[model samples]
Target chain A: MSLEVKTNVAPSKTKVMTMKRLKRREKIEGWLFVLPFVISAAVFFIGPLLVAFMLSFKEYSYLDMVSMFEAPWVGLSNYINAFQDSTFLRALLNTSLYSLGVVPIQLFIALVLALIVDLNIKGKTFFRVAYYIPTVTSTVAVSVMFLFIFKTDGILNKILSFFNLPPYNWFGDTRLALPTIMMMAIWSSVGLYMVIFLAGLQDIPMSLYEAARIDGASKIQEVLYITVPLLKPTIFFNLVVSLIGTFQVFDQAFVVSNGTGGPLDSTMTVVLYLYKTGFRDFQMGYASAIAFILFAIIFILTLIQRKFFGEETEF
Target chain B: MKKLIALFTAAVMAVGLFAGSTFKPAKVNAATKKVIRLGVWASSPAESELLDNQIKEFERLYPNIKIQKLVITGDYNQVMQVKIASRTEPDVFYLDVYQAPAYIAKKVIAPLDSYLDKNDVKDFEPSLLKGFTSGGKIYGLPKDYNTLVLFYNKDMFKEAGITKAPTTWKELEEAAKKLTKNGVKGLSLSIDAARFIPFMFQSGAKINDGDKPVFNTPQAAKGLDFYVSLLKKGYAATPKELGVGWNGDALAQKKVAMVIEGGWMIPFMKDAAPNVNYGIARLPKGDKEGDLVFTVAYAMSARTKNKVEAAEVIKFLTGRQALSMTAESGLAIPSRISMGGVYTAKYPERKPLVDMVKYSQVYQFGIKSSKILDALNKACEKLYYKKVKDAKTALDQAIKEVK
Candidate 1:
């Protein structure tokens, strides 16, 4: 009996030792797998972020960029100057207005598109691919095309003229410029969000819809009751991401406005303004301050959105 | 196990063989060849090809030196500034006169006083040379320049029964009125300060009175008012109003009969509207025979390690032969006064453009010019868009912001 017990104990002890060795091996392998990403993130992301943060507190200009460490520190003066600058404020206001105007309209359109594509229809796969084409296409190319299409004597104007309507100076008109850009932004990006919603729609259990149908619910009612509630998490995710993206709109504005953000600075987004100030004006310290402030604004806005519309999952 | 090991060893040997075959040994004469980098804003493909040919010629002349041309397309100044700040700027780069002052003040560009002799400098137009000189130190050598000239369609002139191009602002207005007809405006102008500054200079109104914007004076106002009156009278339209991109486009499309454009428009007119017969003339005389000249210079970066070699490259590129070659493109007039006659003789269409250099005023928008210009442009746009009623009010507001 003692021999039997000793045999069991010895085998168990060896098994535990092997298990420990396996765990250690897994940890080392995991670290090895992540090393490349970690190194890149440290070098490209974290290092620049740290430098930008340091630059925000200093009186750095283009002249001092070569020996940045030698630049004089000016506390919160750069931040103060950003607040006082009228152009910065205008940019902030324009970006916020742009986001407010674009996000809801884009989301509604995307949701509608997602619902339509999810129905029992022919060539759904073709439609799905067709919708995603714009997302994959280059933004610069799209912006340039939009510029041509929205110009005063462009196709849109030609169409309007057929209906005996007056042509509009879409980009050159200050009042219309931002809205025109916003329209283009929505048109290009709605497909991406629609795809996201489509994924969310697919994940909803058929059982829920089956039960809702038995209750004599209409098609709209079924969507209102079954699909949307389940889509809250996805909706929340897209909202946050879209909000962040719209806030940082640069390429379309830059390309359309020809880098001046003009027709009287009407289409000047915050990133474009930051670019002009940092590179054009060579005020790196002030630009860094603007970047940090923009970061804080986005972070706070995301938190507020989360508090209001975040998913509430019951276990 | 033995077979697997043999396969792995063979794979390793194959990889080694491929790598060894692909790898090239460094050139033996690399140490003797000095590599100089030249940064230039990207132009038309034809221009780039011409530049390449010029570089090849330069290389043939000095076989020991190799030139690497870096073409930056968008946001040229911003990219250049970043490169300068990082001390990684090209040995030689193009610098606009408007941007030269700030660079010179910051010592970002090296002065060429040590390299260029008075004889070499005398070949350039005195005014053109003066544009690159700050504190009596020559910061750059002018490569070429473009001056504003009146481009008028011959067909439109015949339709309007106008015999000759306008030589005065009053004559210009009359021609504009006569030229205004179905679906076409008389004149097209871009809503830009650079385009409007010629009027200010013609009216004997300085853009700045010793670093203060005194352009709200009555003389300046009169010049601006004349431009505004043309717009208000429906005789002149902006490129936007006419549904075109710029004055050149409007002129090409025959949407406008006349456009005051730079020498660069000659080639564009030829390519874009070859059927339309257009004539170039000196801009209609305002208060004086005032016209604006814009020039870019071949400037060396202060941080360049091979300054002497880079200076030599600049010299070769800006020499008479190189200037003549570039002038053949009809994109810009040669900065050298001696080459002007030759250039005009080759491209007779650009004769009026080249002739304007004698009385052309070099752009004097100082170091903080972009800001001042932005304010002025916004004001002008507001007036053009009818957001403001009078030039006086717009100019007043602009001057306030500029201050």
Candidate 2:
């Protein structure tokens, strides 16, 4: 009986070795498959990042951009200057306000849209497609259309006049300019977040809802206790993404203002200010410093969000 | 298989590198013809076609030199800046007088003194030539220029019971008030430095006093006050306030009875509002005849490989023959005094625009003009929107910002 056991174990040892060799081969194949993407990312993404980091410490002008290494190193002067600049400060405040104003409203609208479309109703696909159309449209085309709509005698003002409300210069008025852009932002972005929320809604188990119904839960109660808690992860993701996107807003403001950031610079976002400084003013180093500061702000906000929302969701 | 794929990728990249390097003109033999790239911004399709025709004529005259006309569509300065930075700037390009100072200071533009001796620079308007000169050296040759002129809608003037256009500031104010009726403003004012500069000049207020912005002086303040009061009294309205894009747009749509525009507006008015029945006249004068002359010059890049060829192209473009042909397109008044007669004759309505050039001040605010203009524009906007108490305060703020 002992000899028979030894023979059986010996054969099993060879089997284990073969299994280990197969696993090693699979690992090598997986890396080979991902090699192209890694190489491209290293060339494009990592390359620019390294160059920009090096440039941030130097006084890189348009002339210096061609021969990057020839630019004189100014240490942290660019960063210091950015903090001292009144326009940069204003841009920061404006971008923060825009992000704070747009993110919550846009997400709420998106969630409401997602919930309505997720209901047991006909023509659901039609509603989803219609809602998603703005998301797929070109930003420039949409911004140009919105420019006409927000004009003093535009469709929006005509509607306001019907209700006996006075018309305002949406782009020209300092008080209304940023808010008008925010409204457009909320309108154009709701569709994308709604689609994201819909995907999250479908992932939720039906058994949990059925159980809630058996307990005689009201519609509002079910949504409050079950839906809200279960959708926290999705909400967190959308919140972080929208925050970053809204903070870097440029295209809409640039197009509507004709690249001036005018009407008293009320709609000047940080990115727009950076673009003007870098490309228009040829202050690439200062612009890079502004970019890094913006990145820091977004990074800190994301960290705080993660801390409060908690990363893992057991449900 | 993996090695093969890697090798194929390397081969593709190698070929791309070779193709890019080959894009630049290779060192040619002495017998081979040379190519000279000319950069210009075309305001309209007609202007572009006219330029193309001129280029063809130029190439025909000089068989050994090929003229490659690069028609820059938008943001001409920014595109040219990038090209300059990359050391791929065109051999000859259009340079606005207002921007020439900055480019000259940076040594990006070559001094055309040597080239001008043969080209007869004295034939061009002295002030226009003076605009592109720095440190006793000419940097560019003026191609064409325009001054602000009053463009009044005849039908609107008739409706207002006014026969003649306003010839003075006081008359303009009274006429504007009378014309301000039935949702139609008498004048469409644009709150910009380009529009405001003439008023300052009219009051004998120089933009700069030895390299410092002194527009906040009492003379300039007086001019600015009168200008802003027209808006306050509802006699004039800004284009934005009228829900239009510009003064020209307001006039074209009949939103305003009068607008101050440049020679470039003739074609735009013809195309946009054919039946508006408008007449061009000299801009309403102040203490003295005051108008702003905007000029663009043909400047050669300092680092150009073919300097002689580029200078030849510039000379030809700004010469009598080419200027007369281009003037017929009605885009600009010829910079050369001799060709002015030809331009005025070709387009009879543009005579007022040409007449203003004699007394008009060239639009040059020094090397830091863009910043100064931006500050002034903001200040003007503040005054226009009533965010500031008065013109003095607004001008003061602008002066402080510029300094």
Candidate 3:
């Protein structure tokens, strides 16, 4: 009995010690693996975020960099001025309008695209790759391509003229400049959302649709009653992501307007305006304030969006 | 701005060349070796080539110093501001006269009083230095300058049944009307302040009255109206309308019969459209023949580690030998007032551009230059598109936005 007890105690103790050692090594390895990313994220992303936050409270410009830390602290005045600034307000309105115009249309088109592509159609792979091409292409290249396509004498105008419609200066008109870019934004991003919705469409069990079919449901009825209801989470996700994306629309507007937000600033989105304020005007403090204000708007809007779909997001 | 992009690309190529050379360790005395970085913009390969040659010559002159040439791409002022903010600005950089005032006010560039030779300073065009001077201190030394000139395709003029280039605004309009046929617009114009302000000066209108910005006054409208009327009447179209990159590109592409550009267009024409048969002339006379002078100066960094080396590089770069290369490049007129005659005599065809230097004013706005110019350009666009009813209202809107 003593021999048996000694054997059990000795092996068990050694096993426990080895297990402890393995766990510690694993933890260190995990940290080591992530260390490079962590450092970069801190330096590039988190560092700027923290600095921008601090700067929002100060009154600094490009020339005030050496005296950046010592620059005057104006508390909420920068934020106050942002609200009072007509250009800022106009930018805010333009961005809000752009988002409002973009999100729903994008989501609907993506859903439709996803639904169509999910079907057992001919050349399915070809269609899938074709639809996703724009998503994979660089945004600036796509923007430039679109600029050529939508210019006054571009292919689109030529196509219009073939049907006897008048050529429009898609980028030159203030009324149409924002919309032209909005259309480009929609065209470029709808593919990504379609991919998201494609995954959502494929996730639904065929049995649910089979049951709907058995109950005499039509194709639209099946999509409406069962597929869409079950896809609530994907819909919610796309909505939130698309909402955030639309709020930060800059590159398309920047490329289209050449960073001037021309045609009477109609193409001036909030982020573009913030860029012009900070980089162009060199009002870093004011730019920081504008950034934070945009952040607040995005945050509140996201919160509201979450509330609308929060319960459905749960498993 | 587009020229800056061209410069940036050329700079990238130049950087590649420098990088290739740097891979081989030079057998030099480390104790005596000093490196100074020179920054500039190049509109054409010729400009870059000339700079490279001058840099090599400079290195040979000062065996102890190595010069690193950098091109500040895109918005020159914006990039410089960022570089200045980061305290990593080049030892010497190109400072646009338009942006000189802001840099001067911010004390970003070192005053050249101590580095200057009084005789050398005297040789620089007084108008060129005016933008870089503040409180009796000169912050930059003008390296080169350009004045706007009319670039007309001789073939296009011939086809339009016109023998010579338009000298007066009315003649330009008539040429444009004749050129509007054959799907070619008479003129290529940019709805920009840099292009339009000369017209404003030609309007014989006062830009400001007692510190009150009054471009909205009826007299000032004369310039904007003439500018926009060309667009309205379908005689002149913007580069955007013609689907070209710029006034120079438009001329090269035959999208427009005539364009207003500076010496920068010369090398571009020789390279891009050598067979286009274009002639250069002073910008068509408005009421008073006012032209805007586009110039850049070599400015020393206020916080440079190699201030002595930097000053030496600037002095050499802006000196007579380097400027003679500039005059030869046909990229721009050298800043040395003495070189104007030499450059014109050397390239007899560019006499129109050189002659305008006497009548032209420096193209610069004090502070918030970009904002004011942006406003003015936007107003011009509005007028050109017929979004606004009248030039007066557009001018009013421009002044209001700037205010």
Candidate 4:
């Protein structure tokens, strides 16, 4: 009789009635909860984003901080020039390569680590903390450490030479420099994704795996069918986030190359090029243009990625 | 509504408290005592002490003026840029001559032609003073300068059976070759344009034509080829290859036998490699003669309110006595040409750097010279890493990119 009565009215209708009753007090509390983030985002992030958008069309240098209004507007010329700029194009290509190289490898390593840590194993907290340490450590410190170990005559080469292994010039080689940086990025960031995946893994109910086991599923079959599909949303989230992070890679490349983005500009990511243009060359307008273009690329790519993952969450 | 208002007020107070005083523009508050904020960067305590003593002497000369020294905490040029733009820059600040053209064009620094007298102008080295001058208006007065010279490890030279320091390009190459033995490098070379420009000048190559950097000519290419051959022939290696921070570091650690450095090397050598006996010589002559002079000046900011006091500080700081004191500390050679004799006599090792001042030129090109620098440096790395086999291809590619 209670079930039949409950079925007579929509759950959303009851929710709406309650929502209206509590609107005055609850609205204030809700606003108070989110107000800080809203204000900060408006001031710091959105404000600069709008300014950058406006500056993308103007011929402004950083010489005058208040020259936003005074700088000449050249329509979309700055954007046009960015496309024509071979160096910027090369930077774009390098950044694309970096994103491609870093995102998947980091994602895979992170998931494998997550799976390993999720087990009923000994020293579980120890493994989790060990993996997470790199994420918390400063990028500059890690780059400095890498520089010490990977330098031509460094300890790594000394060890390699002791065993008659050929010493690799890690950063000097144009082919290896960007990949080596990518390796550092992967090593540093894989842990954060692992933590995220670990959280997602715990959310998966034991009943699903038990049902699979009852159906005579093997361990690999249980994982391939149940675990991976359950973690798809988490994987998608990490992929998009890492894609953005990798595209904006600067500090590692900067510290490694001494801010020249060298080894023939092989490690010159878009952000590094944008930094050189805006700060070093004082071409703020052109750099803003490059920034907006990078923004468009990330935005469109994310939307496309959402199309593949966002539609299939009902499993 | 009253409760809501109270909550909002509390939140506002909390938010305001979270933000630090850094948000406040540095508007001076003292009513009677005029203050002049001086911005400086010092790596060592001794350097800071020397500067502090100079400031004390200046303040003693003028009792009314209170100088506040702001020790810069980051990249000096970038910091100064932001400060100047925000109108919060110090009254007097350090300005590198290499960066003078960009700053002068932006009108961030004051022109001190009227403040400086003829006697003072004549006293300064013409080349060094000229670096701070643009279109007959002086932007700053140089405190001191450094010209690059060859620094050789005496013990390594003896080991290699090279008694005297290399005097010519051929001899320099041969000495480097002879020193290339065991696990040590013959020389530590830098791929920076500042280091390479001297070689171009030595080869009778005009790095600049009118307002443009024309660094791809045959003579400059020859200089580039010769420079790269040192690395290619295994006679020289970059500091990174030797697992050192810089050429000086390599020399200090005895990983390299030779390096090209300047006056700062004196104090640095004393601190870093005090046990190692080293000698300085003028950069080995190429076809003709050339060197590089790095100079810095104490310039008044354009936005300085107390222009008179700032100019006075600049004058007192750059005066013969103050600069002579700076030179005495083995920090740098005073910009005054007249101080050259006494300075060299006191520290004979710095004589080569002091003597080469007449031959070297300040690094200057017209406004918006970024493309030239970027292109040339990329070319340098390409040659340096052996990505480009020959100098002509690399030089031409760099020239084409610039054009």
Candidate 5:
């Protein structure tokens, strides 16, 4: 009876094991598909982040290559210096003001334009493409164009001359430099947010609007009730992205000021200051500290935003 | 009696305050066959061309070596510091005579005492040589040098009823005022920081006290005020107002009657505005009566894989052939005395450059020169743009910011 049981090791059992093997093969193929992206994230993103965090505690310079590891560790000294650095403080303040100045104004302008474009109008595609051109153009190209238009003898002044209005030294004047940068930032970025808003506007349910209109709800009231609530997710995305982008703004300031953060360093941003500290001053450790500080600021702000606007808070 | 005692005590204190300490040279390897990479500022096309050739020659002469020339375009010093910190430093790089001390103290660039002892550098200009000498050791040798030349548009001068260039500040002011008209500015001085070095030097204003800022002097205030006055009276344009990179272009287009630019501009002006009649002359003297001369030199890099070869390359680049080649390239005035004559003999139109170099006084900002100048420039920008009116207060603010 025992011999008969051994011989009768079922064909069904073998078939079941083959079926399990097929499922495992499919799972392996899925992992293989994601392998490239995972490897890249590990090497480029995670590795540098870990190193930068470690570097924040050291005193380092390119001249002393090995000094990154060999140099005496001075915990919190770089952070202390960054706090004490009036320039760094000023950069932080300017960056904050710029973020405050740009994000809301740009978002509002973008939303208005998006709403207009969303209306039943002829050549809507043409208008959309025209509005989106600046968004796709290179930052350097846009910056150079703005530079000429705002020059003392450039077109802006020429146009201003028609009305007998005095011209402004956009970049040279310390008081105006930051504001001028903000204006340029708005011009370059508004189009991007506009497209997003357009998409969000389209996603709102037509049924709700129909119901509101039938119930004698005013346009403003309908928009407030239906459009905004439905577009909450989109608004949250733009807000977080804008916050991150504005906090780390470097290119425009660098190009406009010719890398000096000049006209009295009034146009200096945190990223610019970080660059100066890292690359200009050769205080890599200090620069690393600044980088981490910037990261922390962005991370904390993002967290705050998530808490305020996350999925948990349905409104 | 108490007042006299107080005065005496104050006098002693003042003297004590001025008792600035001297620098003691650090110990460095002299005998080892080490490699040092040198970085240099590539201001014009000529320097880059000559540097490449010099490196090749050095390699051929000393085959047991590798010499790397890191060419820096704008903000070379700032870039060099980063490279140095990364231990990817050039052994020798362009050190502005006024800004060399900080790097010297940082010990990023080693002293050339042993090298200087081994080589005879007597043929080089004594004044130029002395500018790079600190603690009785030469750090680098000047490769290309410049002094401010009054590049005047002869057509504008003619239209304004002026035939000759201004030799003094009084004459210059008068010429500028006469040249002023609708749609045309008299001068193209940028109130930005680049002008501060020349302006301060021209007016004989000192910028540093050891490592500290000391631009609170009456002379410093006077210089800054003079700069502001030029903008206020419509003699010059703010960097932003005129647009950045407008100085040469303005002069070239005859938009501005005159501009104070370096010797290198001789070639640029000739090419850009060939139709516009122009001539070069000495910079209008300041109240203190000296012209600001700017010189950049080639030094061996500290991180170069071949120090002997790199030094050889630096020497070759600053030598007669390279100097003449640089001069012939018509980019800048060469450091070697003979190169100037050779260039002039070959190109008579460049005779004005020779005259400009003769009256050129060295720009000595001690160390922290770039930062100090940047601070002053920022202050000037504020004043010229009418952001601030009180020159003394602005200058004081600048001094404070720098400190």
Candidate 6:
């Protein structure tokens, strides 16, 4: 009788009734709950973002700090110049190559690590922490350590020399500086994603594996068909986040290159170039243009990734 | 309901009043007096102590004003740029003459012509003073200066069978070639292409030509070719491939028989490599009979909060007595013309300082210093590292890029 009574009501009517009750308290409590966050977001994030956006449209040089308000506005000119700038184009290419190179390799390595850890590998926490050490360590400290290790007379080449390997200038050589930085980025980023993959692996139901086994599916077949398909959403989330992070990689390159992005500007990434333009050259407007352009690229790439790989979950 | 609305209206007005009050700018309370922040390059602990002493003296004279010393550990030009961006630039900061033209062009540095004329500033070297002038306005007063001097190991000179220090370009080349041997080089220079401007000057080539880099001149080509030939004959280190810090560090380590450095090395060598028997002489003169001298000055930021008071502090710090004291301490050769006497009397061993100033050249900053600097660096790098077969071609490319 209760079930029949519940079924008599229209679904839309029930939703409307529930929404009406929600609206009565929402004005007070909803705001009460979200007020702090709204204030913080407005003060910290939105304020700076708006300022940066405005700054992008103006010519603000560091030389004339007092003349900040007097800086003439040249609408869209800075953006146009940024697109035409050779350094920006190179930085875009470098950042693109870095993103393409790091995301796939890091994801694959993370997946393998997740699989290994999922096997209930002995000392799982120990191995996880060991991998995560790089992520936790300060980037400046890590960059300095790597600098010494990769120097001409450093340990890596010293070891190579013992094996009759000819030593090449790793940090000083233009061709290798970017690759070396990329390797470090991959090394530092893989562990965090490994944890995410491990969580995703746990979320896959035991029933699916049992059912597959009953159908005489092999381990490889189970991984290929069940595990990968189930983990698609999580993998896509990581891919998009990493893509953003890699594009904005300033600290590693900054520290490694000693802020010049030199050894022939081969390792000059987009953020570093933005920094040079904004601060070094005092071309704040142009730098703002570059920043917005980067934002657009990241936004577009994320949308494309979502369209292609973002799968809906049934549960 | 009307009473409740009145109460709410009052509350809203109260909040509005508070916000509006903040917008009208606050009064300067006694407790809110601004500290005078002075930014300078990072120094060693010992140097910091000496500066601290100077600061104490400065405070003693002006008890009401508090001075804050900010030390930076990066390129001073970039540091200045960063500080300017933040709108918290120091009242007084260090300025290098090589890159001061840009700051001068922007009027970021205050002109001190009126101050000098009013104060009747005396005992300042005219040539050194002229270096800081732009647009017929004097920007800043130099505190001290350094001219390049050829420093050689007395023992190395004896071993190489060369009795006297090389004076002319041809003799300098022969001495260097004769001095080259197994595990010991003829000379070590801070030959990193980035620092190659001084080298061009040493070779009788000026980097500036009416605010442009015109290295296409025959003399510039000859200068570049000569540098390349020296490198080819194994007389110079590979650009940026040395283990030690520029010329001084290599000299200190006894890795090179001779090097061209500055007066600051006298104190540095006394501390770092005390046992290395070294003597200083005038820099080997270029074919045009000139040498390069580098100088630094204390510049006042244009946006200083207390301009009048800050200028007073700068004046005291860079005055005749202060300059003489600085030279007496042997930190560097004082910028004052009068202190040249004090420098000579105090440091008798440094014959180089006396000779260098007599024939020392100066680095000139043109409108396009950035492009010229980069082009010059690349050209020198190519020549010094033997990357280009033709020095003239590399120089021509540099000239093209500089323009």
Docking class of 5: incorrect
CA lDDT, candidate 4, residue B82: 67
Give a tens-digit lDDT track for model 3, residues A43-104. Answer: 76899899889999998877653667788899999999998888889899999999999999
Global lDDT scores for all candidate models? 0.85, 0.85, 0.83, 0.85, 0.74, 0.75
In model 4, chain B matches the true chain B with a TM-score of 0.90
State fnat for each of the candidate structures. 0.44, 0.27, 0.36, 0.36, 0.56, 0.29
Better of 4 and 6 by TM-score: 4
TM-score of chain B alone in model 6: 0.84
Off by over 4 Å in 4: A1-33, A312-315, B1-30, B385-389
- Two-chain DockQ for model 1: 0.40
Query: Candidate 5: where is the Cα deviation over 4 Å?
Result: A1-35, A205-207, A210-221, A312-315, B1-103, B116-119, B209-212, B347-367, B385-390
**Tens-place lDDT digits, model 1, residues A24-105:** 9999998776665565567768999999999999877675434778888999999998898888898999999999999999
- Candidate 3 lDDT (Cα, whole model)? 0.83
TM-score of every candidate's chain A: 0.93, 0.92, 0.90, 0.90, 0.92, 0.90
Give lDDT for model 4.
Answer: 0.85
Model 1 whole-model lDDT (C-alpha atoms): 0.85
List ranges where model 2 is wrong by over 4 Å.
Answer: A1-36, A63-66, B1-31
Residue B230's lDDT in candidate 4 = 89
Which of the two, 2 or 6, has more TM-score? 2
Q: How much is the lDDT of residue B214 in candidate 1?
A: 78
State the displacement of the C-alpha of residue B225, model 5, in Å, after optimal TM-score superposition. Answer: 2.0
lDDT for each residue of candidate 5 in B1-403, tens digit (9 for 90 to 100): 5445445556756776665321111113224334445566664565566667767776676665555555677677667765666666666677777656656655666556565543447756555776677777877888877766778888888878997888776788899888889877788887655555555556776666555777777777777777678778987764455554758888776678888777667667668877877787776777654556677776655545555666666677687777777777766677777677877787776576566655455665565665576677777767765777677787888787666
Encode model 5's per-residue lDDT on A1-315: one tens digit a residue.
243346556878766666787789889987776655555566768987897888899987655535566776989999998899888999999999999999989888888888888999998888888888988998889889998888877888889988999887777767888998899999899889999999988877788899889999999998788887778778888898988899999988998888878777888999998887676555778999999999899999989988877773232
Q: Which residue pairs clash within candidate 3? A: none
Candidate 2 yields a Cα-based lDDT of 0.85
